[model samples]
Target: MQESATIIDIRHIQVGYGQKTVIGDVTLTAGPGELIGILGPNGSGKSTLLKSLCGLLPYSKGEVLLFGRPLLSMSERDRARQVAYMQQEVQVSFGITALDAVLTGRYPYLHWWQNESPADYAIARQYMSFAGVGDLAQRPLHELSGGERQRVMLAKALAQETPLLFLDEPTASLDLSYQEEIFRYCQQICREGKTVLIVVHDIRLAAKFCSRLILLSAGGILSDGPPSQVVTPEHLYQAFGLQSAVYENYISGQLDIHTYDRRSAGQPGKAIHVIGGGGTIGTIIRALRENAYPVSCGILRQGDMDTAVAMAFGTDNLVSQAFGPIGRELGEQNRQKIAQAHYTILGNLYFSQENLDNLKAAFTAGRLIIVEDSPINSRDGTAGEAALLYRQLTARPETTVMKLDELLLAVEKRSL
Candidate 1:
């Protein structure tokens, strides 16, 4: 709360233990009211980057600026006053009460012979309540469970009352509910004007709560942006070697991630064209990509669910305006893509005047796959125009109508 516009300015800093460098050329800046999640695979230096900040580890090169001043110039107390750090694990000596542990946060404000004052006790108690550990204040830290001890440690950090907070893998070892609770608390703390940098493993939790995300890989920063940009499949694959899909959850308005095994089906097997829109065809598109069918989706309106699914897979896409009929040029492009693919899929999309051209383009493919789960008349929305076209499509000798499971099996067999 007592800093300039930027709370932390980390220049190109390199940190390591003895001979092996863990983080290199890492440069990032943090502002007030930001909950920034540091994420990456194991051995990606997430913890190393954090340790280098508060003088826990010496940076061989580059510099760190706290409140626009050199980090190296700050005294130990000055550094402690500026930032509160809760490390991944704490090894407390036996018989130390939790309240006494929380009081350690007040050392920077005390003289060598001074004891924790009444006001300090009040502050410690308040934070313990905030961390949901007020009842455990008098209990010995060694007697508490790991989750309880972690919460008490959080209370200690909060009790420090610093402008910036750094927590490394704070929730990684906790139960699912505690993990979410800690993140929610961090979000609230950011709203009240503290900058929090958290090293996290749960991408979904980070995407749900953090304002910004920084993904690190192999001693370097791989991606840094808002959650929407940093939580993409490409970023995940690059950072964690995982095949994944990231999309906005409709109910929670948070980013949702689903990881898939890429052992064999992830390889490019066949080329396919998808014509879909509305809320339909997202699962179909995912199924195609999961099974390693190179997919091109077209004429999906900008914000449509179908468009989001296609983009998440990094598929070739021909987009249309968010709210409009498909235009001549785009429609023609869709047909061209259909012609180029080994097969084209006509999803069980509800027909509407806006996207009737997508249905018309289905006829362009040499082999067409139709997914129909309901009666045609029930889904037709273009005044029976789509029904007439669909009937003709089903009548074609080259067209095959299959249920979702059957289609996946057929594609798997064809790939073999």
Candidate 2:
């Protein structure tokens, strides 16, 4: 394939089984070095679309072009030389060594009745090692574990060395480590000018690795673009009926999703103000939202992890700038939010000079719930000033200090 050449062109294709249409009027253009992820819920035509692209499943209408040539006009061997396909599962009825399975990838390059040459074996072994399955070369394909067999099949596909690769849930059976390994390998190979289209169920993994994403829904394309464009909360809800919090994960520095069940019936009741940061208030915010409470968070810094979670859940939040102490203006805003709320929750966050105003504002709550997982003195970094204020707040007649578990139970009981 040359630079800027279109590797695969799927135009207005319709695919189905018997009389039922599973994919309808989908058009996509993939160029060299693009790693596209096919993502959607089950029965969304992810697998059927993949098979149709490579000719394993017939399309009812429209055309598929490889290198601007009609796909249906290509011979089986000719197409195999340009495209490599890995199915969802591989079952070997007859016993075959793993080495033999991988060596079969080279058949497209051989003549009829011709045996594999030494160079073909070398290529197979090279790919087996690359897939981390070199040690299992002598083992029987049927005797290998699920993950091991997946690696062997991946090796087979890699040995084909085609410019266009189609994988259907290739990492479905692998562990966490191997799942990342397979995606990383695909990324590495795509940099060398390979175009890969893979069907993936793990949204986080796809967001982290794929160059672009295609989301399907009910036999049609829902969204298609880079991960940031395709994995939005609105798209997820429309495609999968999921209510999810979509945000950038701080640790991985990638987009991540946290899905929740459908919201409970009835209007949101009882405003609750959450004053916390340093990643302590995520669960509290989620719990309140799940129970149909109007939740708001305040006095969090712009780049705080907790703030990101709050924004993803559509919480009303008042945020200050990062690395700066809360100003008097924002502090007053927080106090007003606290006054309006029916109840307030103070998460078990460490006390720092930058957030001391948050501690001061907690005094305005009519009914205060303090989560104290550890001693206050241990987490106080503001000399003795924070601990002194904390003592005064806890002594108030409306304050209730309890562990996280007890506080959650109390909230649940109150909601009931």
| Candidate-wise lDDT, in order | 0.89, 0.91
Residues 109-171, candidate 2: write the lDDT tens digits: 999889999999999999999999999999989999889999899999999989999999999
TM-score of each: 0.88, 0.93
Over 4 Å off, model 2: 264-269, 352-354, 378-383, 412-416
In candidate 1, how many Å is residue 288 off? 1.1
* lDDT at residue 360 of model 2 (Cα atoms): 97
Among residues 3 or more apart in sequence or in different chains, the pairs in candidate 2 whose N, CA or C atoms overlap within 3 Å are: none
Error of 1 at 304 (Å): 1.1
Model 1 C-alpha lDDT versus the unseen true structure: 0.89
TM-score of 2: 0.93
Candidate 2 CA-lDDT value: 0.91
Best candidate per TM-score, number? 2
